[model samples]
Target: MSIESPRTAIVGLGITEMGKVFGRSAVDFAVEAITSAVADAGLDLSEVDGLYVNPGIKNDTDMRLQSTLGMRDTRVLATVQGFGSSAGQMVQYASMAIEAGMADVVVCVYADAPLQEGKRAGAAYPGQARAMVGVGSLPFAAGLKAAPERYAVAARRHMHAYGTTSEQLGAVAVAAREWAVMNPHAQMREPMTLEDHQSSRMIADPLRLLDCCLVSNGAVAVVVTSAERAATLRQPPVHVWGWGQAHPGYVNRRGSEFGLVTGAAQSGPAALKMAGVSVDEIDVREIYDCFTYTTLVTLEDYGFCAKGEGGEFVASGAIAPGGSHPTNTGGGELSSYYMWGMTPLSEAIIQARGQAGERQVDRHDLVMVSGNGGVLDFHSTLILSAHPKGR
Candidate 1:
């Protein structure tokens, strides 16, 4: 039998030491993360009947991981990828498998070691200009091959159409840094300000250095099981109430609302509807922050505020630590380790479990986690709660 909504529980979370560490490949980190998650859930390695891996940009981790882990039998195993949206998608997939009796215990993991020896973090993803050709050549001609450049086009458009300013974007970075200062796991915990954001060198017009996310080497993993089984687990169960994904294809043509809006517009409401809750019911938000502009647009699309008012909304400190909306309490990708969507997904689990320590919000009965991949191309949303559905 199939359940209309799977109430899978995230019982364990494994996060390896994040940032600048060397000599370990993505596979090595994956081994540690998965094993830690298994142990965290009070389960033996043998109990993991499914494995879902989202490899880093290096693409070094894959299905063979089952062999390395010595999992002689697994009902489900695969490498899932949707750029940054992979984490939420993995949990959603694992939940379905559990509800269908396809697997018992599953571990969804993401690991990357992009920072190389002797190379600055910036070199991890070089801004090497793509070959100038076709519609993509527009940014290529301007030497904007890197993500910041391509994303800048979208940020600029949002600015022009809605009067978004650089200061508004800086507000996002500054707020992330503020939250990071209170987080022990954050990579850049030093205090930051809007001035720091403004003075930082401009990576792309309208996108400053601080406006971007940090590049790091790390891995994060979460364990999923049926809500019934979670009762016997070691940690408090973070119930997965609902999830939704949107892979809206983009086109490089006039009249296309590419960057101005994102898949979050579709996925957020769908997930909320499935959870039988409204956005106002969400107590915490763990939005993927690949860039500052990403957070702003997602909030707008998620209906956190009126469309085109994200700049003013964020500038008012609505998402800051003490703000009405507690967002990215683990510092997010800006100040925290960048584990792709896992950064936000992991934090959501922490908050839902009420284990965030100093950064934990007082009201975390309901949480919303968002993942956006490929410059607003793919989007996924997961609704988690301290209590199970229909409670």
Candidate 2:
């Protein structure tokens, strides 16, 4: 049975370079991409009706990104601090607004100048700031360190419980690097071996340096509106089928287990149900890869594989290009530019649009992208297709 299509579409997308970004401010990069996106969609600046920014660690009101981009006139303006995971939520909001006649067009954008110096250099929004509160201080108390501790224990437990190996975990880095070799924008394009992965210095007990995602500077933006209006736009439109967010409510050392199984696992089925699709029905995936452990945990949570089988599943190379179900073909955060996993969200849209260039999939009809934020405290998932299937 052919599913009926919905009335929302992603009409445009834009991305900044992914690297050290020594000089350009994050908001500046975002404006560059968004401007390109508006032109690409054949829409004038006056057409935009809403603005949503990620407001990452390097964000500041001084940049006045909304006004600078000439989107301040939009009827709705929103600032969210949840990193890449906020993509789905913003899209959902835009969908709702379009459905209710609140706005005709919405653009979601995120950028961070973490590498840029000044008072804003280290000024992440308060929630993200709190997550890293202890890093630069006396004893290194940031959640970056704390998250690894929790994952080290989880990895150890998974190793003991499922016989997963360090080599198996390293395979993720290896496979991602392999795909990175094809992505011109990826930062760590050079290949590495499992031995290289295992031999790399350890940040946490089980996490080698290679197992972590690089911190780079970049911005990504996407434009959304009613599917009826999108059909008249310059570019093809990809529809949103389903969307959801889940929070696991785990935060500190004492709540390790709760945190491990938080948002990703719990909310995945709900999202799939809303989309009226199963895991096997998804042709492509863009799971967040802030860390190897994150990918490992999210795969299981999202029902891609049986619990505790993520290591083996990833080792099968299913996530690489030309696999049964490719994921993060733009190299993901592990190899691609990182705006705290925001570009992956945009890349997912590109894949659904069938414009992935070198990394395009073979006849992908459905795609899913999951974003994890706040030590896994928040999870947001989006289901997209070339044509919507009645949400």
Candidate 3:
């Protein structure tokens, strides 16, 4: 059965300080974010009846947060697992709970204390030898070993197929850093150029150090409630018009079709269709940017440009501030704090609420936010608006 459209709105947003070391546990960050969000929503912690969390690098669970935060009425507690792509799904769970009358207000949260955890924070996949054997004759053995290696193969393939240049990939990194300079919360605020991106150490072939997302320690939380309830809150409601999720299966199983496309091809259109809007109506785009190629391919998959034409689309600076399409205004994961996809979702909400300060877009009425999980295996898309539907 098809799930009903989300009728909820994000009435509050909160984020803890992001950096290399917070000297605090993940639960501490989660509590701080939830408290801030509750206050921002003009509600007491006791009013929260639902909780959604994606504890990446954190050992905490939903019950722990509910107890620590004093959410005595929390009726719906869920933890979604999609690796980095779990943030958007958290919102989906909250919306579903609210729609079903299981809860009145829901808080979606994510927290990570990677820096404080030291070497344990940077754990690599174990049993690579056995994994390679499982792949059998598939050539993806090496790429499957790590994220960078997988994306590098995709970048190389895109270059060979469409003549996409390394400079084009560098343009994506440069544009993100450009936005970063304006974002105080961005971890890497220093101005970066295409030359700087090209000169950075190569992590995996075409993917450079600057092209990858940051290793950050932080927490983000957003309060979700029905539109009717949000109107009485202190903050403006960023209405959730539409949302869609898709999985393209595993890369190793998909074979040749694996890296050639992303799940956004399905999720993006589904969200727009559900919202009764087209791509051109979107005023802001907050797509996941785990890597430069991730952004490039996602743009193409979202129908922002033709297939294999993402390089030219971004190279034209269309995604920069004041451009035709303002994307990842908070510098995205590339320059912003990498709390999975929470960084982009938070930026989208801020822009939709007209609270983006200097980086705010001229037209902030509509926004399209996308998230990627696994090795381009899972995707989620959301369409948000400044005003609720029919308002």
Candidate 4:
């Protein structure tokens, strides 16, 4: 479906105090974000007919939140989960529902409270060995009971195949840190350099502590409605031009295409095709940076650069603030908050609405947002614009 006027738009956005804030459950953040987003959209809870909720590491669910928020009589209500990909999937489903007349207004939210007072961030995600009790996975048998180790292997495979270097991955980290300094809410805002990235202690072989995303406690939510309905409401509408998803299951070893290629290849093309735009048309990009390598490989997968050339593409500081490719303008999950895909989704909206403050790009016409889940297994892409457009 394509039209000159966008059929659906995001009318409201709410983000709680992300990062290490303590003493609040994921449910608390969910209600806070949902209510605030509704208010931002100039709507009442009673008028909202649809709701989408995705839990985080803490496992807060839609059922718990609906009751906590006193939401009832909704036409569409369900749990959306594809790990990190849920954020984009929720918007895609909400848009489809609104177009089909299933519901008028839908709110999608994700919240997690994994940080406890005095506990280290690593404690939030314990060893995966317990989770692999019943299974005899190759990774588990090899004592790869943690995420960083698994990802390190993937990074190693990419490096071995294409001769990617640490400094190249460090470039992505430096760029994200550069963007973080501009965002007030980012967790790690200190100025960083390739040297700093190299100096940071290694979590697993090629991956350093700086390369991984920060663990945080917070929530991010958005309200979606028809463009016509949005124009009659509060804040300017962020048009939903197009969206797409791909889930390429990961194999534990280097024998498969797991580390080299990701879902961005298919999903990016699909989303851009639906949005009626090209790579060059995107003025800003908010990519999920669960890890620095994730950002680099994803850039290559999205056609921003050729496969196996992500290292050279990012080493030029192009993805930084004063460069050709503006990416992760809100600091991204690497240095910014990590609320799954919401980190990128929230920033995408902020940029699309021209509310990024110092980090705002002059050209805010088109923004590309990506979501990745698992070990680069699940992926989803969204193309957004400030002006209404056909899908």
lDDT (10s digit) by residue, model 3, range 91-116: 87788888888999999998877675
Candidate 3 regions exceeding 4 Å error are: 1-5, 58-63, 117-144, 250-255
lDDT of 1 by residue, 139-180 (tens): 667676678888999999999999999999999999899889
Clashes of each: 0, 2, 0, 1
* Native-referenced Cα lDDT, model 4: 0.88
Tens digits of per-residue lDDT, candidate 2, 1-391, equal 2223336888888878866676788777788777877777889878998777776656652235677876555677778766558777778777777777778888777776666444332222222224334435433353333445555666676677667777877877777787788777788888788889988989777777777777667777788899889989988788887777887776456536652464877677877777788988998888888777777778888888888888888889887776776877777877777666465677787788888778788867888888887667778888888875654
Model 1: how far residue 280 lies from native, Å:
0.7
Task: Provide the overall lDDT of each model, using Cα atoms, as 2-decimal numbers.
Answer: 0.90, 0.74, 0.84, 0.88
Identify the candidate with maximal TM-score: 1
Clashing pairs in 2: 57-124, 134-141
Off by over 4 Å in 1: 1-3, 127-142
| Candidate with more favorable, higher lDDT: 2 or 3 | 3
Q: By descending TM-score, how would the candidates be arranged?
A: 1, 4, 3, 2
List RMSD in Å for every model shown: 1.8, 4.3, 2.7, 1.9
